[model samples]
Target: MPKAKKSQAKPKTKKAPQKLRQQVAALPVRLSEGGQIEVLLVTSRDSRRWIIPKGWPMKGKKRHEAAAIEAEEEAGVLGTIQDKALGHYRYSKQQADGREIGCRVAVYALNVTEELADWAEKGQRQMQWVRSEIAADLVQEPELSLLLRKIGPP
Candidate 1:
């Protein structure tokens, strides 16, 4: 009897890490004065780095709606979305409990009409408005900078 031929199989592709499944939302807002496209940045709760006004999406809300809400809560700004998405980016966040989780953020452009210094109600660390180009440079994640560039300055 002849020996059976040996079988071969291809290797499977590795999946992305589950720790990379976090979702967040950001908004690109412009000042009404100089018509300059500006971004609202916030300090992390741990004071680690400066970043955009973004957070986990609330249950039962669309991504863009969550982006708008995070903008209002973190930066104390009220605005209307332009019905457009700026882009997306990914990064890592360290929670207060010492857990580091990867995060993905969806960005949107908003036409801001007001600014209030009342972020305490939402438990934000700090907020500031910077020129879009400058703001893009300030973010720690390279993907976010690229997204900002794609959105362009107002």
Candidate 2:
């Protein structure tokens, strides 16, 4: 009987981990007449999901500043933006080509003082002001929901 031939198999190679893209977002907020925290949410252009205003970093602007700019453009709100980040959340963004990219967003709290009647994204998106607790329920991101919950009155 001929000796059995040894099997030769190719070594398995691990795929490289996808890099997480960095972004800045603003959590627009205001105090209701009853002194309750109200969060301003904007509908995403493509999916129409409720999400905070976010985008890539802008030139000659700090992280928080860029976040504020995004808020103005996407949500049509303006106010004092905090320098420090409230927290960060990770999400997968779907691209036009059907690829999902990993992203990490640094959230800054923006106390909205003014809302524009006609803004860049006014017609493109719907804006809503809801109680913090309700806003938490309205959003899709878990970490962002937790952040919204933290801003509610004790």
Candidate 3:
């Protein structure tokens, strides 16, 4: 009797896990006429979901400074930003190749002092200043919503 031929199969290789990318965000805010705290939110470029101004770390810039710059460019707002981060939130960003990468964003409080009528990304997004409670309800990120709910008098 002839011996049975051995099966031939290639071994599966595991793909390397992607590292979590670091990002910074500015929680722009101001006081309403009734002395209630309000937050400034901008519509995301792709999904149009409400979000705070955020971006990747800028070269040679501190984390808080980068957050402030993102607020100006994305939301057309500028203000005094706290150097320390208020909190952090995790989210997944879709890349051009359709792969999702995990991102961790450090949020800093920005006391909005100036809002420009014309600025970068002006027409690309819609912005609103809502009471913190309402702002919490508007955002889709649960962690961000919790941060909004925790905001109190400055």
**TM-score versus the correct structure, for each prediction:** 0.76, 0.91, 0.88
**Over 4 Å off, model 1:** 1-16, 121-124
lDDT leaderboard ranking? 3, 2, 1
Clashing residue pairs in candidate 2, if any?
none
List per-prediction Cα lDDT, in the order shown. 0.72, 0.91, 0.93
Answer with 2 or 3, whichever has the higher lDDT.
3
Candidate 3 Cα deviation (angstroms), residue 5: 18
User: Candidate 1 residues 1-154, lDDT tens each?
Assistant: 9999878777788986666664656665775377767777777667647777777778998777887787777677777865456777888777789977887777777667777756544564756778777877887899988776666544
1 or 2, which is superior by TM-score?
Answer: 2
- On TM-score, the leading prediction is 2
Descending-TM-score candidate ranking: 2, 3, 1
Error of 1 at 154 (Å): 5.3
Could you tell me the TM-score of candidate 2? 0.91
Q: What value of lDDT does candidate 3 attain over all alpha carbons? A: 0.93
